[model samples]
Target chain A: MGKYLSFSIIAIKHGYKNKGETIARFAFYGIILLVFSSLWNAVGSEKIGLKPRDMIWYLAMTEWIVLSYPLIHTAIQEDIRTGNVAYLLTRPIPYIWVKFFEGMGTLLLRMLILAFAGFGFAYFITGGLPTNPLGLLLYFPVGIFASMVVTLYQSIIGLFSFWLQDATPIYWIFSKCNFILGGMMLPLDIYPEWLQKIAMLTPFSSFLYLPVKACLELDASLLLEALIKLTVWAVIGLIAMQLIYLRGVKKLNVNGG
Target chain B: MNLKNNYEFFTHLLKINLKSLTSLRGAFLLQATFMIINNLVFFTMWWVFFKKFKSIKGWEITDLCALYGVVAFVFGVSVIFFGGVRSLAKMIDGGDLDVYLTQPKNTLFYASSSQSHASGWGDVVSGIILLWFSGYLTFGSLPLMLTVLFCSFVVFVCIGILFNSLAFWMGPMDSLARQFYDFVVTFSIYPQVIFSQFLKMILFTVIPGGFIGHLPVSLLREFSWSNLGFLVVGSAGFFILSVVVFNRGLKKYESGNRFIGVGTN
Candidate 1:
């Protein structure tokens, strides 16, 4: 636990050191927010019961969730490709734990930076934050759990690199699934009934939609349901990651990587 | 180079790129397949949106489909023909300009066309399907549609080169360059009516997302000679600007002491 905490602290320092890249990324996020705010303002005016400010706030939260997660798959894939995974295995701590802690550290810092920037953008555009401040505060833990679930899923995709020469296409497909089914651009409530039903059944919604919805609306029942679903999904993701990791390591040992 | 020589060089580069891409047929097919699915899923979001709201500011499901088709087709054509535009920042930052400098050919043209992406075929297929399904594929509109597509392709490639050329001055700015490219592409897929006047102005001039994505679709939907002329002139201007920028940036490029053997792959 202490080792993992230390890893997280080191990763946070690394993120702080890379302030230039973070600032550039934050600027890009601001542009994206500006575009989306304009889009929602225009579209919401046409649609019934759609408030542009609320939708923009929802988008701010969802985009923060999307951008907060580090691209752990890319690092893992590179390690496997370049035979660095063998060196990683020799470390005192388990490779997966190291990755998880480092990823968490980076993700926490990035989330704060992006969330602050995103909220500031939203406030500047919409002139206020969401009305449900308590809900927003409560959403931090749920968001963290959701990020872990996504990380585990990405780790599974990365583990596939042990077998496939290039797992980029597979990762692309997974990301598209998250973008569409997860409702990154728009809330799932706005989707058709059938599409909403399908999306709700998938774990993708738990990643962005559920968290954003909780932040904006603060529905106790909905939050409870989302928490339960997210917990289940996180467990499933962890099991999948562990299974894949074991098989990948076995293959690597046999192949002398 | 002369026009004829340039045409011949482009064709030769296209052939090499295509051959290299097809060298691994299975991987190519997988990539193309996944890209098609990815695009279809993206379209589904709009499909769902239109199903609920019917239309936003006179832009219907079919219009959105056409918008997607045009943007996807333009993007596909650019990546397929001049895929290296996608990696221009990385190349510039890695000092990969050494080989291009040694050659007598135009550096920007050669660098931009040096690679081809197989997934572009998926986009082309999905885009044509969307255009046809949206009833944009009429005999009367075919010429106009093709013209819009060609102009959009020019604008797309120009935007890519313009952004990626920043690496020559900013060092290895892979993420920043990519985000700008992605921003342009994302803004292009939406209806032009969604933007306010200020946003619309930015789209046309600063980012030129409007010229590449919005204006082309709008021109195709309603054939206005004036708008078409604007698009033509805008695309030409952007293309010339990109070339000028690339030339200026080339003077600042310092080799990173990396040996890149030609034809090694």
Candidate 2:
């Protein structure tokens, strides 16, 4: 626990040092929020069932999840390719746990910065806050769980670098799946029934769609269901990461790393 | 350099890029395939959107398809033909400009044409497919559509060069450059009528998203001599401006005292 806390501090420092990049990213997110606000305001009507404000705020939540996650895949892929994982393995701490805490440190800071930026922009455009501010405050823990699921999934994808010469194309596919199925661009409920059903079945929905949906609507039953699904997905992702790491490390050892 | 010499150099670079990509045949194919599928997944969002709302403002699903098709094609052509534009920030920041500077050819052209992106072929393919699927492809409209697409291609590449050239002055502006590039891309695929009058003005001039996203669709759907003129002039103006900015920025590059290396000797 102490080691993880120390690693988290290091990651926080790293995040702080890259303030320029963070500001640029904030600008990007803000611009995207503005564009979406204009789009939703223009298109949203009585028939669409979503208010412009709600839709924009929902997008804020979703985009936060998409943009704020640590680029764990790149880190893992680089370590594997350059044989840095060999040196990392010699450390007293376990590699995956170290990465987890490091990722948490960066992810928390990014989430807060981007959320504030996005929410501020949404408020400026819509002239109001989320309908359920209390629910939103409550949704923070659920959001953290969702982030863990996404990070663990990324770790699994990154570990594939040991076998694949380049895991980027694979990660691209995974990201696209997360974008479409995860409801980063639109609410899953807005999708066709068949597509919505398919999306809900996937872990992508638990990673992004469920958490955002829970926050926006703030239904007690929905929140509970989303939490349960997120927990299940988190467990599955952790198991997958552990299994992949074990195999990847064994392969690296056999290759004389 | 003369047009003939430029053409020869581009073809030479294309040949080498193709060779390097084909060397890793499986990875190349997989990358292209994934890119195409990725595009299709994005398209699905629009599919669901139109299914729900039917149309946004005056734009319908068919219009959305055309927008995506044109934007993707323009982006693909820029990357496939002038792949080096995407790497401009990294090259400039890393002091890798020394080689291009020393070369006798046009530095910007050399820098942009030095690499090829295999996934761009996927975009080109999917873009054509989308255009055909959208029912906008007709014998009567083909010529005009081609011209507009060409203009869009010019504007896209110019915008990329314009943004990436920031590295020359600011030093190591990869993230900022990429975000601006992404801004152009994200806004270019949406319906332009959604933007307020002020935002529309900015889009037309500063970001130039209006040229590639809105104007082409308008000109294609309803022939407008004024819009067509704007498209042509705007493309030319932006292209010239990009060249000027890149040349000016080149003067600021400090080389960082790094060893200059080109392709394997």
Best by DockQ: 2
Q: Model 1 TM-score?
A: 0.93
Best by TM-score: 2
TM-score, candidate 2, is 0.95
Model 1, first chain, TM-score of 0.94
Identify the runs in model 1 with alpha carbons over 4 angstroms from their true place.
A45-50, A253-257, B258-265
- The DockQ of each candidate is 0.58, 0.78
Q: How large is the interface RMSD of each prediction? A: 2.1, 1.3
Model 2 residue pairs with clashes:
none
lDDT of 1 by residue, A22-101 (tens): 88778777877887776666556336355777777777787787778887778788888898999999998878778877
lDDT of 2 by residue, B177-225 (tens): 8778888888898888898999899888878888987898888778889
What would the DockQ be for model 2? Answer: 0.78
The global Cα lDDT (0 to 1) of model 1 is 0.83
Off by over 4 Å in 2: A253-257, B258-265
Candidate 1 residues B1-265, lDDT tens each? 7989999999988988889889989888988888888888888877867666767778788888888998888888889999999899999999887877878898898889988999899889889988888888789998899888999999999989999999988887877787888889878888879778887898998778899778888887788999999999998999999999999999999986545666666
